[model samples]
Target: MEGKTCCVTGHRDLPQKEINHVKAALRREIDSAVADGFTRFMSGFADGVDQYFAEIVLEKKKTNPALELIAVIPYQKRLDSLMAKGRTYEMLEACADVVVMQEKCHPSVYSHRNRYMVEHSDRVIAVYDGREKGGTVRAIRFAHQFRKELREIPVGLILDKNRTNLGQNRI
Candidate 1:
């Protein structure tokens, strides 16, 4: 359709509660996207939030057949790190259109994957802790540089700095 396509990115390691928060935010984003006539989703298939996004899209596809879920994998060997590659394979086989960046694995493949996602998407939904480095930060930077609309769920913003419990108490 002539609507937006969104890509999902997030931290690789997160606490369970934060993961749930990210999922909740994603659900809201998906709902908003659907309302805005966006029916396509792209995910990089990373361990944490990416996988969650894909799974949610797959679930939504059951009722909304018009939705398209595309898995943009960094490399083929990324499957090795997956706890259950078969599940991912089956999901991709059943719901997603797979795009592999490189036939062989490389340390830099994830960057390629992030670029591909950003290039193909009109918007980015990021669950970021606002780290200065890492793939999520890099992807956000790319989105910013490309002038793509960014929907960021800042999970770590509050915990980033420890201040006084009361108003303006300094040691």
Candidate 2:
């Protein structure tokens, strides 16, 4: 297998079960990348799957000194709303090479950050719930538009079984 840079993207509001599944999928993808001699990883540093991927890379780096984890932050200080930002920052501080999309926060900086990750990566690993909007959807669409190889993990199983109306309810 040939080495290649792997990028990760996913939904931010994933259920706990779905989050675990997505994390497992990302670990597999990262392991595959390593088997293929790829030691570099890039993550958007979002709350859910992005954080999971970054953590996995950080763990791998402890055992494999050659592996590199890059945190492609969408904007500086855009993480204020995320409860996991502190932990993500700690992980970034430990093992990641940080790349800020903008020196300051902007409304559309995340979109630009996603584009940058897709443009620079050899492939994308995405966890989506088949939504037509949101940052995850946009990132997947960007990957498709750019003709990048995508490994998708759909998280529809996370939705409540009793809930039929998705519009008024949260997944």
Cα lDDT listed for each candidate: 0.81, 0.79
Query: In lDDT terms, which candidate is top?
Result: 1
lDDT measured at residue 54 in model 2 versus the true structure, 0 to 100: 88
Residue pairs with colliding backbones in model 2 are none
TM-score of 1: 0.86
For 1-171, candidate 1 gives per-residue lDDT tens digits of 345788998887877767777888899888887888888899988888898898898888899988889888887677545425677776777554778899898888998899889888888998888689899999999999899889987776533442333335553
Q: What TM-score, computed on C-alpha atoms, does each candidate reach? A: 0.86, 0.82
| Positional deviation of residue 127's Cα in model 1 after best superposition, in angstroms | 0.5
Model 1 collision count: 0
Error of 2 at 149 (Å): 1.1
